[model samples]
Target: MVRVPGAKVALSTASCYPETCTTAFEMAADLGFDGVEVMVWTDPVSQDPDALRALSDRFAMPILAIHAPCLLLTQRVWTTDPWTKLQRAREAAEKLAAPTVVVHPPFRWQREYAREFVTGLARMQDESGVVFAVENMFPWRARGREVAAYLPHWDLLELDVPATTLDLSHTAVSGSDALAVCDALGDRLAHVHLADGAGSNKDEHLVPGRGSQPCAEVLERLAARGYAGCVVLEINTRRAVNRDEREADLAEGLAFARFNLAAEAAT
Candidate 1:
């Protein structure tokens, strides 16, 4: 439980700028984030892994990247002749010296592929020295418990790993208490996906403090439980006006977080 905070903005690739990894790194570096989390697809036609690593190094931030099998990018879990794509992802993560790598659970592409995918990721973790984690899908059962029950169950099912992303907004969308989920995860949690939401079945990714979920309260809960994973905010970069807007949002989130952190310390 380290209370390590990291700001999350987007790269230029997704919707901000299509051909600007270097530009994206420059902008992300200016945002004062501890690390950059990237999501890439293993499909043959998807973005290049080499370019991703180059940008990560350019920004002087070790990578925290993800690779999920996507349909357009050949969304195959452990089957589907996905060796080429998986190898590419592995090589890229290694090259970037990324500390954490997230893989999609087998729920989306194939439910049966979960075991092999996790095992493969374990092997990748061993080979690359990266913390391999899998994100629990939206329809996971613990959504009923504000993400708590599901966190333990999800980790138990994974078996080999001991970390997760406490997506407070996703839990709220599922009609659950995000703080309670934090309690369930305890120290096994690795990071958080932060965003304020209206506590409905929506994932609009509202700016912090604008939606129903209290961002500061969530941080307080994490601190109380001695959970020190990264509190990385995720927003749609495509919708932002420019880098300045993204930075402003991050600044506000940081202020809100600092207040909660201080309160947590006092408590």
Candidate 2:
């Protein structure tokens, strides 16, 4: 096993206090994270390159990656056209000097967009220097029935995409082994959303080691595989009763990442 020397540990801006992306950067900086993953949502500053760059400078934290506005709440962000949204995300990444832009597959209802997803993604990668890391989403469960919520269903191994972002939370929700999925992904796994989840249909982004998923084991495997990627702490801290608890969670996530990716561990 070839252990990675030093995989970066970043915090996702959307991890806590969805009020503004600035809080994410501030919390990460205070917790001594290596950098941050900007999740562009309804926050106007999230979509503005100049503002994002300014925040990075102010916090002295690099923007490791940019998550495109792809969630249900961000449907009306850049433009109604999914392709346009992707293009704008790429531009933002380029301006921010972020190497990757994480995106989600279109919804099942977006037939036309889904049809061109694979090819379009490849084309975008070729045209833009930034990597378009497609994220895995969970199925929509309702009335004791399971339905494919995403265009390509949460598994990217079957897809011919160039890169992938594996989220442990999503894996747990899918009731799949985290290690098995990481093995299946191989080199295509370019980014990671470091969170844990219980075996539930709901998408719960629990902090690492707090859930049943082998979050630490997965990190060790990534190190052993010499995976050079951005590990962003993407946990949902909405349940945090106060700022102190929230800060503690973020600090724990960062420490866990550093311990697993330390140079001594790799050696």
Candidate 3:
């Protein structure tokens, strides 16, 4: 098997969904993941840096990245203020020695936050010495209509962020070509959320090869480009019937990532 020395395949805690963050660390370690991306959400353990550090030590799994609490459901998490949430996320990443922090654009309704998001984020990154990789989001589709849910648009290319997180599932939902976006981002692409979708209005987060996305191609491209950033498995396992099922799905995702990433060297 060919290996890309700079690249590492990490497991996102969000993939564990209903499972606790502790369970995610255990699963990542059990499945031989290079590291874990801590998705800061409702899980109390996820919010506690010391607790997360304990789990990291317990499992010997490094915290590759920290995903800020920017989801709608996480509005109250960390705090109601969006900037504060990002600040806390940066702090967490720094404490855990993670190089990057994944954040989403402000919701359209948060006019004040959106107004200063670009400049604010730049300032935060400069002060913290952390890479705030802005994640691409998709427009809200309902009743056959598209709503511009995120301010400053959902497309990363349209924005002037220093670094970005290319989420393949979001690309699938937005009907954007994954390979093209990947190429366009180039070095601005500081992180990746590796998942697949079937071009549905809903974010499918399917296994890599199970969807229409060019998942393998993207991984291969990253490998060829000598991408040192983490390729995190952010697939959804909420539908898993049991712990075994979840573990199987995670294992499959890890295998897919490693295989495709190695394709570059094999050639």
Candidate 4:
């Protein structure tokens, strides 16, 4: 099998949702992932750096990245203040020796935070020495009308951010060409959330190659370009009936990533 040396396939802790953060590390270790991206949400274990480090040590799984608690359900995770949440995320990443932090654009309702998000992120990156990769989000749709939910638009192309995280599922939701966006991001693409969607309004974090998105193509392209970033599996397994089912899905996703990420060896 061909292998990409620098590209590491990681599992997002959120992928184990309905399962505890601790379970994610266990599963990642059991399944042989390169590392994991911790999604810091309401889970007490997720928010504690010491606890996370302990799990990492126990599993011998390095923390690849930290996904800031920016989802609606996690608004009060670190605090009500959006900036504070990012700050804490960066601190946790630094403490864990993770190289990147994934953050979503502020919601339109968070007026003050949205207003200064671009500049604020730049400042944070400069001061913290961590890559704050702004994750792409999609516009909200309701009753056949498109609603502008995220500030400065949900499309990363419209934003003037230095670093970006290309999430394939979000690209499907936005009807964006994943490859084209990747071409545009170029060296600015710092991380990847590898999942698929079928151009649905709902973000269906389907397994790679399971939906309509070019999941395999993206992995291949990253391999061809010698990408040295984390391709994180962030699929939804909450529907899984048991740990066995979830493990099966995770295993399939990991295999898909590994197979596609490998380029033909030089003859």
Candidate 1 per-residue lDDT over residues 55-93, each given as its tens digit: 666778656654444333445543365445556666666
Question: Candidate 2 — what's its lDDT?
Answer: 0.87
Off by over 4 Å in 4: 1-3, 265-267
**Against the hidden reference, what TM-scores do the models get?**
0.70, 0.95, 0.97, 0.97
Alpha carbon lDDT of each predicted model: 0.54, 0.87, 0.93, 0.93
Error of 2 at 111 (Å): 1.0
Poorly placed runs, candidate 2 (over 4 Å) = 1-4, 262-267
Query: Which runs in model 1 stand beyond 4 Å of their true positions?
Result: 1-21, 41-46, 67-88, 115-128, 140-161, 224-226, 258-263
Tens-place lDDT digits, model 3, residues 1-267: 565748889999999999999999999999999999999999999999999999999999999999998999998988999998998999999999999999999999999999999999999988987899999999989899999999987999988999999999999999999999999999999999999999989998998888999999999888888888889999999999999999999999999998888544564
Better of 1 and 2 by TM-score: 2
Kindly list the per-residue Cα lDDT of model 2 for residues 33-106, writing each as its tens digit. 98999988888888899999999999999999999988888888989899999999999999989999999988
